[model samples]
Target chain A: AQTVTQSQPEMSVQEAETVTLSCTYDTSENNYYLFWYKQPPSRQMILVIRQEAYKQQNATENRFSVNFQKAAKSFSLKISDSQLGDTAMYFCAFESFGNEKLTFGTGTRLTIIP
Target chain B: EPEVTQTPSHQVTQMGQEVILRCVPISNHLYFYWYRQILGQKVEFLVSFYNNEISEKSEIFDDQFSVERPDGSNFTLKIRSTKLEDSAMYFCASSDFDSGGPYNEQFFGPGTRLTVL
Candidate 1:
């Protein structure tokens, strides 16, 4: 069984600043994928960035980047130059290599204050 | 941009009644999936389907739940008997198998809010 945990229930950042949301997971599978998704009030899940366990390089998508520490079972999302539109519920997810099931963290409510 | 779409944005049903959720995945996507999120809880995987059959399913997708692709563009999930616990947001997702990549990215829909009273 695999599980994802987001320790921070809520976080806030001033506009143009940066924010980091923490996430950890428990999985025996050596090869897997980690992802960050954003869900606004509209309820649509938008992909932020993804990191492959086999690759040590962290994934970056514009302002969104990830720090994936495979050994520590930690994968955190960092949003740089945050904007008001970044206010949303962010989720960390895990999916084993070639598997369809995606285990998700409890989610972190992020608010970008202007 | 092509994206997954689900119908019946909101549904309110009585307990013990049958409810069917519909989804129209991206045209070229070969894989389809269903996920659910209870209020303020983590999203949970329900099932995955490919080639007109179920490839895998979670324990939550028990006998009471079933999935079908009755047409070229429509995929549906049927809940035989709804419980109060069924009140949640149901999401439809789709992906194209990335044979050469490390992992495939699943695109999610806006989600359907289902409330069982």
Candidate 2:
């Protein structure tokens, strides 16, 4: 079984600044996928970004990017130019090569200060 | 982009009563899944369905829980006897697959909050 851990339970960032949420995982599977999901006050879980294990190149989606360190089993999300709307609960997830089920981290509550 | 849709944003049910949650996944997706999140807890996987049968299930999904794709569009999860512990937000997701290929990214629906009293 794979376990994902989000070390930061809560984080705060000023508007227009950058913040990073950290996550680490334990998995023996060589191939897998990593994902970041955001749940705002509305409680809608939205996909923020994704990273393929085989891809060494980091994935960048507009203001959201991931620093995936496969060797160290770390995948952290970086939010740049944060806005008030960026405040939300962020979850890190892992999916094994053949599995469709996603195992998620505890989550980090991020607050963007205006 | 198409998305998964779940009905009845919230439900209140008495203990021992049967409750069914409904979802309509993306039209082209073939794999369906059910997940639950207790308030302030991490999301947990309940079950996964494909080819009109169950492909995977978690220990939490006991005999009381069952899933069925009754029609071409609707996927349903039925709990024969609801328990207080069953009260949580249930989310449905779906993914597209071809042949025997590994499952790809899953798209989630707005969860249904189930309150068992």
Candidate 3:
């Protein structure tokens, strides 16, 4: 079974500042995908970004990027020039190749302070 | 852009009562899934459905729980006898299977908060 871990329970950053949310997972599978999802006050799960394990280059989506270290079993999300809208509960998820189930971390509540 | 949508944004029921959560997935999606999250807990996968049958299920999906796609657009999750522990946010998701590239990106719906008192 794959297990994802997000050590941080909460985080706060000033608006326009950069923030990084850490996540690690234990999986025996060689091929998989990692994802970051955000849940705001509306409580809707929104996909922030995703990274393929096979890709050496990290995934970047505008201000949201990921640092994926396959060997270390680490996938971290970085939010640059963060805005107030970025404040939400962030969760890290893992899905192995050919598997439909997604394992998710507990989540880190992030707040962007003005 | 298409997205998954769930009905009864919030439901409150007594323990031992039956509860059904409904969802409408993307029109073109081929796969459907159900997940739940207890308040302050991580999301947990319950079941995945494809071709009108269950493709995968987790330990959390016990005999008391069932899923059905009764019609063309509606996917439903039914808890036969709800327990207090069953109170949580139920989420419905769907994905399209593309043979080329790992394109099984699941789109999530705004979850329904189920409260069993």
- Using DockQ, give the best candidate's number: 1
Cα misplacement distance, residue A61 of candidate 2 (Å): 0.9
Task: Kindly list the per-residue Cα lDDT of model 2 for residues A1-114, writing each as its tens digit.
Answer: 999999899999899999999999999999999999998887768889999999999999999999999999999999999999999999999999877789999899999999
Scored against the true structure, residue B113 in model 2 reaches a CA lDDT of 98
Residues A1-114 of candidate 1 have per-residue lDDT tens digits of: 999999999999899999999999999999999999999989889889999999999999999999989999999999999999999999999999988878999999999999
Q: Candidate 3 on B1-117: residue-level lDDT in tens?
A: 888999999999999999999999999888999999999899999999999999999999999999999999999999999999999999999988643558468889999999999
lDDT (10s digit) by residue, model 2, range B52-95: 99999999999999999999999999999999999999999888
The docking quality of candidate 2, as DockQ, is 0.65
Q: Which of the two, 2 or 3, has more DockQ?
A: 3
- Mark the regions of model 2 whose C-alpha exceeds 4 Å error after superposition: B99-103
Structure candidate 3, residue pairs in collision: none
lDDT for position B4 in model 3: 92
lDDT of 2 at B88: 98
Give, for candidate 2 chain B, the lowest lDDT window spanning 10 residues: B97-106
Give all candidate RMSDs, comma-separated: 1.0, 1.5, 1.0
